[model samples]
Target: MGFGHIPFDVSHALAGGMLLMSFVLLYQRRVPGLIAALATQGGLLGLAALWQGWAQGAAGLYLTGLIALVAKAVLIPWALSTLVRRLGMHGSVQTALGIGPSMIAGVGLAALALVVALPVAAGGSALAQEDLAVALSVVLLGMLVMIARRNAIGQVVGLMSMENGLILAAVGVQGLPLLIELSTAALLLVLALVAGVFLTGIRERFDSLDVAFLEDHRGERR
Candidate 1:
């Protein structure tokens, strides 16, 4: 409730940028495009952390912001780019819904998120409330993308987008300790590594990165 020390405009800008990027990500079909959008979101997250640190004078927040920048913004993107190039899997997966339908669904999902969160009124300030709403919307949208798209790469991107939303939610919560954040970062790394391994397995068996081929493997036998 205090928020006297925090820089409202800068933090809001950062959170807003990430929220906008989530919408942009939904429209991107190319692997490179998704990676770029994710990197942009990461940058915005770092900016938000920096603004929070400045406002609260919390050294941990500054470090968390830097971690988000270096790891999510830079390292993750670089690794994904390399993985795409190395695997030679640049094609986008065909979703069950057409692009138009996907866009409409995304709009609906965002609206649903806002509507659901409005009653709770969890945030102390307007910016936190906005960020929380937008972040949850992004998370749901990411899940939608994953479910609609049939491609493994698209699913991965969707998962990353969900992670971005999680980070946004974490930042919005007040008084969360830095240790939890650090542990979260560690867990994210482990998850990404596991995903990479799963990707390799998918590629090895199918000779392609498309999830459809692997998905129907069981059903096709009969």
Candidate 2:
């Protein structure tokens, strides 16, 4: 009824894939590429949950996986793509930091995550500890993505990516209630829809999705 029943390598592989996708998100420049990377991360997250469910005999994790697949992997990405197309934002991403610098920062953040996670998870299983470390790194990287990007769509993608890390950490642990997981997923869906609507309004008003524009408008009003 625990990860002890499953091969550690399998869970590691799935979680590792999710961490790798976070790095990919850091490297992406174009809108379409960013959406694709997010979708791929969602898929990896679903697989990780599925393996965890099987390992822990938690049927709830399977449902979490399904939700992630359908909502995150398919629905959210499709919506984002449509939004990008309609808004004519099919261009390179604008970042506040260069790729090399961002990546170096990401690596430093990742190391910090490991350092923090190991001590915190000292009482937990090795698998859980590793998963938590990776999850922490993903969360930090996702935040970096949000802070580093100027595009509205890129920021939204980063927000969702951070949520993915939370889900990963939740599923990695045993005995966590399924209700919490479902609620978290539902909240994210609401967040995505709300963000999309908000972005549309912003674009219509200012004719630009750059947050800097909004700040400039506010400054002019003031």
Q: Candidate 2 has which clashing residue pairs, if any?
A: none
Most accurate candidate by TM-score: 2
lDDT of 2 by residue, 79-136 (tens): 9999999998877988889999999999999999999999999988788888899999
Model 1 clash pairs are: none
lDDT of 1 by residue, 1-222 (tens): 333434766676677788778777778777898889988988888888877877777778888899999988999888888888888876675666777888888899989888887666664566667667888887998898787777777788788888878877877766669889999999888877887888888888898877778648868652
Candidate 2 residue runs with Cα over 4 Å from true position: 1-6, 220-222
In terms of lDDT, the poorest run of 10 residues in model 1 is: 1-10
